[model samples]
Target: MSIAKKLVGQTAAYGLSSIIGRVLNYLLVPVYTKAFLPEAYGVVTYLYSFVALFNVLYTYGMETAFFRFANKPGTDQRELYNKVLSLIGSSSLIFTAILLLASGPIANFIGFPERQEYIVWLAIVLAIDAIATIPFAWLRLQNKAVKFASIKLINIVLTVGANMFFLVFCRQVYNGDYLPELRPWVTSIYNPDFGVGYIFLINLVANALQLPLLWKELSIFRFRLDVDQLKPMLRYAYPLLFMGLAGMVNEVIDRILLEYHLPDNFYPNMSNMAAVGIYGACYKLSIFMSLAIQAFRYAAEPFFFSQANDKNSPQAFAQIMKWFVISCAFIFLFVSAFRDEIASVFIDESYHSGLVVVPILLLANLFLGVYYNLSVWFKLTDRTQFGTWISVGGAVVTIMLNLLLIPVLGYVGSAWATLCCYFAMAAVSYFLGQRYYPIPYPVRSIIGYIVLAVVLLLGVFYVPVQQVWLNYLIGLVVCALFLVIVAARERLLFFNK
Candidate 1:
């Protein structure tokens, strides 16, 4: 129970930055949706999907490898950190240069030949972010959750500030909306034709600032190549790299597929890019679930490694899983219950047509979180190959389903594909985890909470309440009922410990 408390505390610390930062970032969805047309915003969406994929490649699982090896008995963590940082730093430089050189061709390939600068800016952003991962991982491994959160919050704050400066203030001034006196200053710095390019440029500038903030952590990093240590770490991380790539496929390929496969004029008077923009905007509705998972992961990865040798680890893990699912299930229910309100508040009406997929995407992210929890088995046991295969299988499912359904159902098909893929991965990981690592993960209770959440969400959708206020009252009641049941069942766990 104390272990659970510690994990919860650390997660809360991490969640401070992740949840708040993401909410702030989520605010940008409204700004962007309003500022750019759906087609323009779709370009932003399409390009960033590739950014997510390349980000995995840039670090290539080295952060996880550092954690695994650092915890080994008799290991010198400082030297290990030096080696990991050196390898990533060098590789990032090479990768960034190559991408910069090919920026034009790459932009042309993505159908954005006029915007090669976006590719260049994102390349720099990716490299800086990749190199910074080790320092951040080092912070987590050393249990510096406060410092970690502080740095993350700083980065996001700067990112958000820059975004507002360029997108909101400058754009508005340039358009003569307000502050006409500042138009000359805004014009001197901002190009109205830049359009969505500011998003990438601001991101690059924000990521660049992280290097100075992480200077203390990076100061200890020495430029050294320890080939002997490098070989073993690579062996461990290579599978994870593959797994990460496959996982990215499952996560982002739907956007890519939707961009290419949706029929022209599929929606009434909407192009494929417009549809992609709508899907991307609606997808932001799932940010709460994704943020929760990210916070848990930031704390739980190192926690799992530290607890790997404990005699009672299985029980502790089982309890952790129960609480994690309970929390996520509540998020699922709350978000699904208020999906319409959230959509209206966060995105333009032009994008509201895609709101139907928000619940599906939320549930999919819930299962993705479950899969992350279950994946601790492979990471702890040094059987990362299982993770590789499971993620690949999920990616295959995502692809096949998207291909079969996108033409028929559009972005809705992509949402269902996401749900099916994540559910399948989580199920497979659970069975394989039981066979290998064998944690008693309160499977019955976990399933019960999820099923109950789904049923309540259905009630929220189909309940015969004509008045909006009455409907909101019932949704609140449904959420309160869930909390009441959870508190009643888990009273002993809370009070006893």
Candidate 2:
């Protein structure tokens, strides 16, 4: 099979799992928004922001390093895997232990003194998740897409089901809404005071469940730390650790910043935390773009490494970049065009005020996807320091803009900062990729499609028609126009090949 076709197949498998699983997971948004006030929901948002940052720390780019070293000629893949898992596993235990000992102080520091258990729960979740990374990456390296997808789907399903059982079934029974006879059983397990804490606890349980599910992969793991093998891998990966941290700052620091930096009463009748909650809820609307990026990343990472030695790799990369841009543009246009309807379906009405950021975030994530595609240059050429620098630059932009803009424009400022950061990162990465390890990406065509999508989306938003049906019809027509144009331009690329 052609490289493009193979990638498409693997990406489709991964996408099926990611997109479907996340959609199910996202259903919790409405449940949470309805169950807890915005102020309460904001706690979930805030804590998870920290989780995203620490997750990068726990894995520390070793997954990619595993991929890099394992693919090297004459390397013992099994021994390399053992060393990588052992390093991460031992460190994860130490990290979790420290967190457990300090959970009380950390809870006090975060203003959650009463909920110190949250820290303990998340620490375990982090460790389990960190340990599981190599196993998951191993599955990818072995091209076990089906198994990977199945495990991922099962995790999501279990998480969603556990959430419903606790938040919906237990709460309803405890409140006497239904199943009054089961109130005794529900009362035994459910504590109303736990509130949003159940979200964290459920996640801990779900992640713990993954250990047994991945036993087949984990069975081969034996604790061994080969310093000779470890030093070079660390050299390649430590930069990625910083890069991933900075990249996460670009992705999630806004939520954290919005919580503290947003001015009092900026949204009228809303606390700063409530505004953060609303922003978090509305951000889910951008998952369409994120889903595409994540699926592509899953399949593209290993594929890129495998193809690095190919003579025609540059052309293959260009083709992948073009299609990736096209796919993301469509997601941006579609989601932004129907932003209101989608928000209403998935987010509660109380959280609808922050929906304005959806389009901005969608566009930002589109640029993020492009940056991911462009980043293959640095990864393949082993110039990972360049990746670190670009990400740090992006993080600086994110931090500065959040500090300067949040006070002035509220969460809207944070949204604008995200867009600016990702665009800058993508532009910088593209230029640097050209100078360092050039991939002949279809630059003009990529930009043209993005511009066209933006224009059409704008037209959908600014149409004079006041009728709902008319607006939707206009959206469909414009979307169809985009598809037609793309099909005409790329006719020979897919079908002929």
Candidate 3:
């Protein structure tokens, strides 16, 4: 098969799980909003933001490291797998213990002293999920996308099921909508006092459910350390640890910072949680873009490492970057054009005010996706520290921007900070990639595509049609025009009919 076809197939398998999994997760937003207040939902968002950071620390770049070493000629795949599993397993346990011991102090520091269980639950969730990372990466390496997708789908289903059981069924029973006989059972299990805590509990339960499926991956008995082998792997992965952490900071710290830095005076009538809730809801509008990026990353990382030795690898990478950019652009235009309709699908009315940032966030994610593609340069060349520098710079951008702007512009400022950080990161990565591992990245054409997308998005925004149907018709026509122009300009690949 052609490399393009293989990439598409692998990406489709990964995307099926990623995109479908996220869409299903997205469908739960309305349920969460209904079951918990904006304040409560905001708390959920806040804790998960911390989870995002902790997840990186817990896994600590082993997944990528595993792929890098495992794909090499001299490395023993079995020994590599055993050492990685043992390393993460020991660290995860240790981390979870420390978190548990310090849960009280940490909860207080984070302004949630009253809800220490949130800390405990997240600690457990992160640990389990962290240790499980390698097995999932193993599935990817093995070309078991079907199994990967199935396991992912199952994990999400169990999570959603657990969420519904708690939020939907138990809530109805508590509200006296259910028959009185079932009350005893439901009431014993359900506590109105739990509130958003149930969300955490359900998540912990869902992550735990994934363990039994990985019996084969985990059954090995290689608990002994190989110091010689471990040294180089650690050296290779350490920079990535920094890179991943900073990257996550770019991704999630806005939600965390919003909770802290939001002015008491901004959103005068609403509490901090309310402001955060609004911002968090609108952020969901960018998930489709994230989903696409994640799917591509899953396939691309292993796929790229495998093809690194091929004579045509550079050209292939360049074409992949072009198509990747085009795909992200289409997503940006689609979401920005229909954002009014799309934003309302699962978000509550209270969150509507913050939806203005949806397009900004989508575009930001596009930049992030591009940066990920450019990052292949560093990863391939084993100059991974460059990634650390770029991401750390982005993280600095994130912190400084949030500190400066969140007070004045509220969550909207946070959104702008995100877009700026990603834009800077993508540009910097591209320049760095050119210097170190130059691939003919079609720079002019990529700029043209991005500019055209922005212009079309502006037209969609300003030239608003009155009828909903008419607006959708306009969006479709604009999408077609963008496609035709792109195809006409670059008929070498996508439009070569």
Q: What lDDT does each candidate get?
A: 0.91, 0.91, 0.88
lDDT tens readout by residue for model 2, 1-497: 27778889889987888889888998988889888899999999999999999999999999999999899999998888899999999999999999999999999998889999999999999999999999999998888888898999999999999889899889889999997899999899999888998899889989898889899999988889776869999999999999999999998899888888887788889998898899999999998899999999898898889889988888888888888899899999999999888878888899998988999999999999999999999999999999999999999999999999999999899999999999999999999999999888889999999999999998998879979999989989999999999988988567233
lDDT score, candidate 2, position 310: 88
What TM-score number comes out for model 2?
A: 0.98
Q: The CA-based lDDT of model 2 is what?
A: 0.91
TM, every model: 0.98, 0.98, 0.96
For candidate 3, lDDT tens digit of each residue in 1-497? 26756787889999899988888888889788778778888888888888999999998888999999999999878778888888888999999999999999999998889999989989999899988898888888889888889888998998888888888888888889877779889988999888988888888888898888877777763775666778888899999999999999998999888888887868968899877888888899899899999899989899889888877777878878888888899999988898878867788777788888999999999999999889989999999999999999999999999999998889989999999999999999999899999898888878888889999989887895798888899898899999888777777465212
Q: Give model 2 RMSD, 1 decimal.
A: 1.3
**By descending TM-score, how would the candidates be arranged?**
1, 2, 3
Candidate 3 TM-score over all chains jointly = 0.96
